[model samples]
Target: MKAVVVEAFGPADQLAVVERPDPEPRHGQVVIAVEAAGVGLVDILQRRGEFGFSEPGFIPGVEVAGRVQKVGEGVDRGLIGQRVFAQGSGGYAEQFVADAAGLVALPDPLSARNAVALGVNALVAHFSLRRAQVRPGEHVLVRGASGGIGLLAVKMALQLGATVTAVTRSTAADRLAELGIQNIVRRDRETEPAGPFDAVIDPVGGAAVPALLGRLAPNGRYVLNGGAAGFPPPEFGMALVQTFFNSLTFSTFSLNSVPAGEAGAAARAIFADAVRGALVPVVGPVFRLTEAAKAHLALEGGDAFGKIVLEP
Candidate 1:
């Protein structure tokens, strides 16, 4: 099998595709013939040692979509040929070992490529909005609204009957419009959106935190899911203080925090929606599995317009 190995944690250059012996499924696990894997900001951060938990010689993918090639003890034999998407480790390779219990069977119409794109990203969006307690007829602003999670966040907000204003780059304006988002705010613009939003879904946490916080309506909810641009500036604390009178709420979410059973149910619902064409996962650049370094570079550099997928 060919797998991307991180010899050291430093930069995208640290990722190299090298040949490795095929892995066998462990008890309760299945070996997936990986068809597509997602490259996310979390992977980039992990590669750069920003997370501080990852060491060298690690495979850096968490979500994958493929067919089950083999199953270990305690797993169903019928699962061998099942098409599914899973959230597990070592996905940036031609094959990945994932727990059979955690695999969500993919609908026949959903391609492996699209499943990988929607898997974790949609889960994040779903859980974030649900936590924010988003209600119909409310107004929501989505920062980084053209990215993988952001795009899904926009759709999810609309499905909840919220009026959505997208904050993204001009390069993604057309795509945002295609999703029927009319109130688009350019991130490059000096001025901020005229917001008083009921909720804000921010994936790009940075200096804009203070300003975005100020735009929130009284009793508004803000959910921070990722920091692709980096963490909020030191002034964010004072920003929170400044918004104190509004009775605002700020939260941070990770899918890891959700119980496995609940997350699995949500993932199954998301897959069903994708099958029904209610949710469309946008795929940005497609790269060969061996080109993991380049894929990481594209994601880290903000050059990715949608969910980046690496195919084996």
Candidate 2:
């Protein structure tokens, strides 16, 4: 099997397409013949040795869509040949193993390619919105509104009957409009409309967090899921103290940390939403599996409006 192996991390050039042994499923796990893999910022970070997963020779992908080739002991035999998507480590390869508890059967209506596009982005959006307890008729503002997670956050908020205000750079205005996002605001002028929003979904933290805090309504929730702007070491003590005094809620989420017992159920719910058209997977570009370097470069370029995928 061919896999993108990172023996050392520094830049995209460090990744090499090399022959590697196919993964063999262990107990409670299944090996997937990978069809498509989701490319995300975390993959880029891992490639650069920033995510701190393990040391060397790591395969960075976290989410993948493929067909089950083999099921290990203690796994159901009926799962063989099933089409599924799973979230785990070492997904950027032609074959990988995933825990049965972490796998979700793909719906007939969703293609393998599209399922990978949904990846962790949609799940994060679902988790973020649920944790925020966003209600119908609430006003929701999504910072980084054109990003992989941000775009899904916008869609899910709208689906829940919230009026969404999507904040992105000026250049993405037309794209947001095409997605039926009417209340689009440029990031440079994000605070101009003056919101006392019921909830704010902020993935691009830094100075933007304080601005988001200022826009929140009383008792409003702010969910921070990512730091697309680069996680500058924040002054959390004083800022958290201020949040406590303001009677507001601040929370952070990582889909990777979702427990095994609940991961499958949550992923199934998200997949159902996608099948029903309540959530759409936005695919930006597709690259061959061997083109991992190019994929990383494109993700770092910062101009992409949707998810990038790698086909195996």
Candidate 3:
């Protein structure tokens, strides 16, 4: 088996492609013959040593879509050859092992490529909308609406029958328009868009929170889960003050806190909606497994429009 190894961990070029031992499932685990894997900002950060705890010489990738080749102790043999998506470390390889508890079988209608596209980003958006309790006819604002997760939220909010206000750069207008999202704002503009939105889905957090709060309806909910602009801004007190003054709701979403089984269930639900033509994932540039380093470069340079995938 071959894998992308973060050897020295400084730049994208440091991600080396090398032969590695094929992974075997331990008790209660499953090994996948990976078809595709998703590249993310976290992968880039790990490549750059920004994640201080990530040491060198580790295979990195959190989510992947493939077929189950083998099942371990206490696992059903019937699961073998099932097309599944699982979350775990070492996804950037031909063979990856993960907990069987985290695996979800994909219906025949979905492909491995599309499954990887709709992986984590879509899950985060789904959980965010649920936390915000977005309802039909409500007006929702989505900041960073052009990014992978932000764009997903825009489409989901629309499906929920909410009026979506997408805040993105002018470059994204044509793309958003193609998605039927007509209400778009230019992020470079100094002025905020007019809104007393029923909910605000903010992926770009930091000093922008206070301004986003102003857009929400009096009793509206604001779901903060991403840090596209950056995290832990100099101050976070404004949300506290605003939440106190208004009968507003502040909520959060994290895959880490939620159990793996729960995440897999939600993903299957979303995939069913996808198969029904209710939701579609936007896939951008793709890389071969050996080109993992270049994929990280494109992501670091902000070139990925929706989801970046690696085909093994």
Against the true structure, whose lDDT is highest?
Answer: 1
lDDT of 1 by residue, 1-312 (tens): 999988898988889888899999989999999999999988887788887355788888999999999999999999988998998878899999998888899999999999988989999999999989999999999988889999999999999999999988888888789879888988776467878999999899988888888889999999999997889987786777887899989889888899878989999999899988899889999999989999988887776788999999
Relative to the true structure, how large is the alpha-carbon lDDT of every model? 0.90, 0.85, 0.85
- Candidate ranking (TM-score, best to worst): 1, 2, 3
- Per-residue CA lDDT of model 3 for 125-147, tens digit only, reads 99899989999999999987877
If scored against the real structure, what TM-score would every candidate get? 0.97, 0.94, 0.94
Q: What is the RMSD of candidate 3? A: 1.8
RMSD of 2: 1.8
TM-score of 1: 0.97
Name model 1 segments beyond 4 Å from true: none
- Cα shift from native, residue 222, model 1 (Å): 0.5
Query: Model 2, residue 179: what's the lDDT?
Result: 85
